[model samples]
Target: MRYVHLYFTCIKRSMISRLEYKKDTVVALFSFFFSNLCSLAAVYFILQAIPALAGYTLAEVGFFYGFSMLPISLDHLFSDEFWLVAYRRVKDGDMDMHFLRPVPVIFQIFAETFQPEGFGEMILGVALIAVCAGQLTVSLTVGALVVLCVGAVFGAVIITSLKVAIAALAFIFKRSGPLLQIIYNFSNYAKYPLAIYPFFIRTLLIFVLPFGLFISLPVDTLLTGAHDPWLLSLAIIGAAAVFFALALWIWTRCERRYESTGS
Candidate 1:
């Protein structure tokens, strides 16, 4: 409990510090919100033409798109640093400072960076969910709701683990930043109905990257009465475990090779 309080205090301090740069922060916040608004507009236009794709209505598609924003919001809230900071720390040899702290190094690193833009997105996503939910008229059992939440949580974990795994490559390679951009492009697959995708692409997403399973299938089961959500959620749990385990093992191995600038 004490550690939890300290963790939050650190985050609060970080937020306060960010507010000190009010002008720059406001610019960044507006830029991010506008970019996402553009994405939402694109989805609306695309669905306007097709009306529905692969048994999903526009509202259902919106729910999938909207539901996905929840995890993306959560990801930005907690693990945005994991996407960019790991490489910066490794390259700058500043990671040692984190190691010297009593808390877990990753925990300290994550706590220090807060994305207020993500909080803004979360508020917007909740409103979108409310609108989509009414249009979808989905029945929700207590058990199914639990599974949906678990899937969302585990889905976020898988994405974070994947980011860490990719970022850890910086320790061995000269610079992995370029490759990270390419990997980020894959996130587009999450913004649409996976059903409309080709079989091979769908297979790759499910077996290789697993992003499709993260947002699409679980939510589809909820609003559309698809089936086997419990089993699917368990599969997500398994996939998240595998992804994180591999990432942890790799990160541990790479830590030994870290060379600090400061003696």
Candidate 2:
């Protein structure tokens, strides 16, 4: 409870800092919104040209794309500071301030930024999902709805865990941003139906990076009834728990290796 209060307090401070430049905030929000809009438009154009992708219709593809944004946007909202840590802060010894704080360094990093730009993505994503869902003929089941909710919420946990684990490597290597970028790029592959990919790429997305596990699989379940929703939801929730625990372990171990650059 104390930690939860501290988290909100830190988030409030971060929000104040960001809102200090109201124009910049508005610009950033619009920028993210348009960026996502452009991507969605690209998908629409391609679907119009090709008509279908790997047996998935245009609406199915749109639903997949829209659902992909949920986990990514949530991660972007809460953990944007991890990008700075991975790319700059540790190398510049900027994390010294976080180390001096009473709270855990990881907690401080999590609380350091509250990105309002992600609201743009969230709004656009929800809107796209609603639009695409209306065009599809999906039978809504209790299990299916549960899986979608779990996938979106717990999927964010999985992505954030991956970010935290990768960012923590900066403590040892001084910068892990490139590797993190490479891994994160894999999430893009999840923005489409997994059936469109080759077997090996599909396996990698499911088992290795696991982006497709949470994003594509849940949507597939809804559209095609491909998997047992109860099992898939359990798998997503379980994977989130495991990934978060492993990420915390990795962060704890790597954090001990941090050395100030003395800049």
Top of the candidates by lDDT? 2
Candidate 2 local lDDT, 78-187, one digit each (tens): 99999998999888888888888788999888888888777778877888899999998889989889998998999999999999999999999999999999999999
Model 2 worst lDDT window (10 residues) = 28-37
Which residue pairs collide in model 2, if any? Answer: none
Cα lDDT, all candidates: 0.76, 0.90
lDDT of 1 by residue, 1-263 (tens): 97789889999999898889999998998998898889889888877888577777777877777778777777778877765655476777767777777786667767878787888888887788789888766678875686678767887788777777777777777356667666756766865667778899988777787878877777767866565877887888999999889978776676567677674
Candidate 2 wrongly placed segments (more than 4 Å):
none
**Each model's TM-score?**
0.88, 0.96
**In model 1, which regions exceed 4 Å deviation?**
261-263
